[model samples]
Target: MALLKEASNLKLITFAAIQERTENFSYGELDASNKPPPIQVKHLNNDRITGSAAQKFCLFRLFPIIFSDMVEHLKSFKIYLILREMLDIILALPQRKSWLPYLETLSINFQCMMLELLPDKATPKVHYATEYTKIIEENGPPLRYWCMRYEGAHLYFKKIAMQSYNFKNIPKTLAQRQQLRQCFLMSKCRFLKSYQEASGNKIIYMHEIDSKVKVLLNHRYGSQFIQSQTLLQCSQLIHNHVIYKQHAVYVYDLEHVEEIPVFFQIIHILKLNQEWIFVVDLLNTDGFSTKLWSYRVSSYDRLDIVSPNNIKYYHKGLDLYKVDHFHVVNLTSRLTKTN
Candidate 1:
């Protein structure tokens, strides 16, 4: 019965057999035409599959086939794998819980393979500028294959059609098309946000380390230790500890809860000393609320923060092979200064 129904559907569509003399669709033929081809709107009156289900089916089947075809066609071609931040990509996925895990797993696998093929050094540097320039630099191929953030997709497509094929102008009017294009760009943003939120939550467990740091400092150095000490003895103790000695140290003063001053101090300290500092918020929950106020300290100047939220960002940036030292200090107690 299923096979019969499928055959009946195939029979309904009109099929045309092409002779050997038929002209294949080519860029030259498309360009030589005086006017743009008519955009056909297929009006389906029947209540067939829902748009969402059809989209899922098409994505699952047709998308894979398209990628396979692309790979086959480009076997001799140099492909550029343009990637956004992982958090951004994750946030951009559809919000349905049922599909998220699978999407995440697939994205991770794809990213790993892409990175291996084109190592970081081989890929062009990412910058916010003309999308075409970035794409051209990243790949050896013509500019047509470069992909970018959805915000630049329309401009990219427009440029490709005009420059690559010498098309005068696309028939579609900007006013008539802007709404649909914007909708796609916005949808991409939403998808990215969803994945970023999920990824951010996954790293929330680091808050445990913050809590432990607070407790350890309070117990050993006394409650008023941070206020009295010019330099945190606990930090030296951390340096002495096997696990934390190599990690760059940053101390946050809970007393000054404002954003600019704190950030200025952090930036100044880093710039003057040329050392990356691992930031620690001195205040409890209240200080964590502001996005701009928190500090990030690291050993390397080029260290990138993985988390979108500022509070959870901390240093795990140490060479594990080096010998480490640990010590404990009381911030309230006066001690002789030593180099």
Candidate 2:
């Protein structure tokens, strides 16, 4: 876990994702997708490659839940840097098509470094490293994707079978029922109207500000944050989200006992008496939720947003190493103009 938060590790992960082998190679005339080809690699390297970084990372730490929690503890400058590198490396491995040669080079270096750092331990080789390269050159899809789908289907079948008492012809019956159901579903009209559409709520009339910026109403949680009288005509209307400009609103940590400013991006906004109520996505900078480590999370069911007077202006720059398990954009160092 400690190594997971290291700055070096995160940086390595970054290099694996973006950096080319010589840092001078050009990938001209990319396809319509504008992305490189996919890469394939095996999960194991056999008994000889024991206790290797590649093995541990690819096999053990690849799980999203575990990796996300590990990313939260990276706070100190030294640790943050190491963690950034580690994340980059981990992310790069599965993206074999983008940087196969570079990944191979880095994996070799990682294996060597791990062996030297822990001299007494026998380092496991990257299982099927050469084989992975050959498979990728021959244009193979990632084995992990197919394996996961198969495993999921197997589990589903097992669970469904366990629930039924009739084991005599379960397999045959299940297959027939599934096929019939699938065919029935497939025969349905592709343009079938949903309940919402049939109910005439298909198009929601959104209030737009200045003909360009569409106004969003406050959710139940966001409405409770501000005083009732401070709100204007749209106070009672509840919405899922709102978008607002940074100048019109500021993010405050209502959940924290000490109540301080939290950096967040305002994705939506609502108009009040005179101020703007914001719908914000929390920034993953100071605190992150980890099961292993208790941290302050928003009391609101969704992310909490505030409209405070204290709008601290700071330079924003891109921090590519920042990871958001919730899939929200973290605050960048790049500066944006505000009133």
Task: Please name the candidate that would achieve the greatest TM-score relative to the true structure.
Answer: 2
Q: Give candidate 2's error at residue 166 in angstroms.
A: 2.5
Off by over 4 Å in 2: 1-98, 113-125, 140-145, 189-339
What's the CA error at residue 275 for candidate 2, in Å?
Answer: 28
Over 4 Å off, model 1:
1-177, 185-260, 264-339
* Backbone clashes under 3 angstroms, per model: 17, 41
In candidate 2, what are the lDDT values of residues 1-339, reduced to their tens digit?
A: 223224235553332322232122222121111222211111111212233233233323222222443344444323233323333433322233544565456555544554454334332443333244445556544433335467555665676678766689998967876788678966864435321111111221333222222222334435542334232223121121221233222233333443323556454444445554555556543453232221232323234445533334332211112234332122211122232
TM-score of 1: 0.17
- lDDT digits (tens) for residues 70-188 of candidate 1: 22233111222122222222332112233334534444544454455434423332222123223333442222343334435556566645555544445554433666767877876
Please provide TM-scores, in order, for all candidate models, with all chains considered together. 0.17, 0.35
| lDDT values, one for every candidate | 0.27, 0.36
